[model samples]
Target: MLKQYKESSQQTYAYGLVDHLNWLDANRLTVASVRADHLRLYMNALTGQGAGVYGVAWRERPPLSNSAAANVATVVKAFYLTSNQADPSVVAWFSRDSSIPQHRRRAVTQNPLSPRRGSARPRFLPDEIVTALFEPGVLTSARDVMVVTWLVDSGIRVGGLCGLRFPDLHLVRDHPCGQRKDPHVHIVGRDDNPNRARAKAYHSWRTSPDGYVNDGVIRAVSEAMIGSFYAYLLDEYHPNQHLVDHEQVLIHTKGHSAGAALTTGGVRKMLRRASQRADLNSYITPHAFRHRAAANLYAASDFNADLVAQEFGWSRAEQVTELYGRSANRHTMKYLTEAWDSIPGRPTGRD
Candidate 1:
């Protein structure tokens, strides 16, 4: 699983497996003996629809959300499939229906537990909340400000931001490293970082003979982002450079861990604290900035999903289109209203 998935994903699966294993123990059911019907019963218990022996364990907790339940089901199914490689009989338990096509049979048969994909809208921070967060005293440190600025301006994943190395940053235009004429940062995916902050995307990157990165996903930075970065460098970063041992761009600036590369967990904790200080009605997250940035880019690019996808390192515009279709609808309605108003003979609502 470590070779096939990111550490974070493996951790999630491990957690889900633990829950399943506990439930199985409560019911005295071994993995080899559990059938499709038993699995359905387990799902029912997870969803709070059935009272199994494990019900006592989960009685105090709320039922799993649709997405979370789906994840657990997926994890369980994957576990059995892997087990099936050693024992072929496990396949019969999952694919009991003979009518199902051979190619269509999946390890996890879809049931009521499956979540409807593409139904939920991506949550983003509102402009007013973002403005409030930027106000003086809301974010007290240059490092915090720079973190928010980069997330909002570039829409890079928090993992990518935390995983950044000094060599990945090309702050000057016409950098001696590559042919890109604008200031940009390369997001390089690595599994070996001491911080375990890995870039989600797997775009290939290699350093040039001159010690500059090339061929990674390049995220263009705004002037504001560059300014905040410099502020962090001069005001906080440079003063603490003597304590650093690694090349990662973002690092702990205080305590015994000062100068160590920051992790995704650290970024989340920082945002949570900043959000609380800003007196926000709801909690803010690092990915909210990415969502807002995508929406802003979608509107700024004249509703071009392709451009938004390219800017955000997405492999396909279809992913962007699905995520930002709501933005497109809002802009399209505004344009339609303006077009109607332009017609001289059109009746006003006042009439």
Candidate 2:
């Protein structure tokens, strides 16, 4: 589970599961023969062991998020299914009907934080905020401005942007990366090891290619941004090489030297610094730009979630529609004006 999720969070979960499995075996059920209902009971035992979150049925443990719980479920279920030491007695307890009935489970009041913790989605940036972020010297680094621009325009996640390669970009309209009448870029969801994952699909169960999502004005913007990043990489580090030996695009800047792909923590730090420079506050983050960009297109393009989702390489359009697509603000105002213009004015109505 830790290796698969790759979130620093799963470590605690791995630890908890290991500890509890030993406890479970001491009482009755062996680890391999654990069933869903038995698992629920085991979860309750953890509550007795101070796993519950501040006097509730939930665990107060650090990594006990709803998503983490879900991941734990997946991990444990996989563990039981794979272990081959279960006899019929073990299998009986592990039967499909082993889910704990509602009556037998922990009966307690729910805390909003306990289950179904939401995804970390930042709000969409307002136009004023973006314009503010780019004020002269607000971003001392030339690279910072470009990062926000690309993030907003391209709707690419911070991780995905950091993982991009130099060869993947095609900036000019006539270049191979360009889409006939549009600006385009080729990007993929590469794993920890970027070299071998080239041309592979991101989620193995899904069919979408890793090198998907190219062609749009955002594509051109991304290409331009990547080009700028390349310039920095060359000027600051390898001035003679055409191919960047490093796999990641955005590298850390240590005083005067070039570093590795701007890490997630570093990205946050950059935003914080920029925010301090501008001396204005609310919230500013990478995903904010992505959200705003999605809103921009959604507001302008007849509420097109499908198009936005595909271009952004989202597995579903629900988030785009529910979160991004709306009928108000600057974009809606312009749309409304155009709609009014299309209809003849000076109408007579019964007063």
Candidate 3:
């Protein structure tokens, strides 16, 4: 799950969790035995670094947004809770540990970084702007909508989206394709030789990290989109003549011929072009859609934070407080206008 989300090295987040877990095991601290203070300490450690040391991997790109850092913290916390479910003694230990400590953050004042500046930020389009972003054959054009929709609806990172396969999508309702809870649209990421022993459903290429589901999201992904994706696969993606079967979802164009699959870089390029057409400011990119969706859901929801988080496969809602922060309070004027004016032929100013 972590590997699938595009950002600074997503794998780093997963690996970091592993590193933290190993430390806990080495110290004889059970997962439920972990507490908020410990998680806070990890967060503080991450924040203390000069931007140079924070995560050199994302050179040229901006530091992970504060929201992203918090999310990573939440995932780490979940790692303990989920791993500790069998032991009640550990659970008691964590509750008494208390909340994260308040600390003044230091500025990341480093200049010697590696790679390109463009990589620093993963770009995305805002939802409203997306309607006008595509241009038939060009980037953000008609060809772009399916893949773009994949990012918006699935919220899967570029890598995961790139790792999808045709068999993964659920063409019919109720009956899951391949038995995975992941929507019928096949996730592209897969392990080199994953332990299929316990991996029946959730056919994501990357190993499973967390298990959170939002039924509303499942409901929002229309069957029409799935059908369109199917048409795309059959009409566009072709594995190859030599390969009897291949395991990838979104494929690349074969210079007028179909090829294996779209590369991660290719996905990024498409996103960039789409954002440009949408007339979004420089900051908006393909990834902005996920942020937008999470943000939109937070605003539109009836203060149902947990419900909103569940749809995005998020395990914790507390950290998303910022996303759901203002909510619909100020936006209530729209509702009021509709509510009173449409009261079954009620008198209007014009009348």
Candidate 2 per-residue lDDT over residues 27-115, each given as its tens digit: 66566555445566554444343353121233345444454455455555545544676444444444434465767545532221123
Cα deviation in Å at residue 346, candidate 3?
26
Q: Pick the candidate with the highest lDDT.
A: 1
In Å, residue 227's CA in model 3 sits off its true spot by 3.4
- Sort every candidate by lDDT, greatest first: 1, 2, 3
What is the RMSD of candidate 3? 12.5
TM-score of 1: 0.83
Q: Candidate 2 regions off by >4 Å?
A: 1-114, 117-122, 177-181, 192-244, 326-351
Where's the lowest-lDDT run of ten residues in candidate 2? 108-117
Candidate 1 regions off by >4 Å? 1-3, 6-8, 26-28, 41-54, 58-71, 84-90, 93-113, 332-351
Provide TM-scores for the models.
0.83, 0.58, 0.50
Report residue 217 deviation for candidate 3 (angstroms): 11
Q: lDDT score, residue 301, model 2?
A: 67
Which numbered prediction scores highest in TM-score against the true structure? 1
Instruction: Give the C-alpha lDDT of model 1.
Output: 0.79
Give the lowest summed-lDDT range of ten residues in model 1: 51-60
- Candidate 3's TM-score reads 0.50
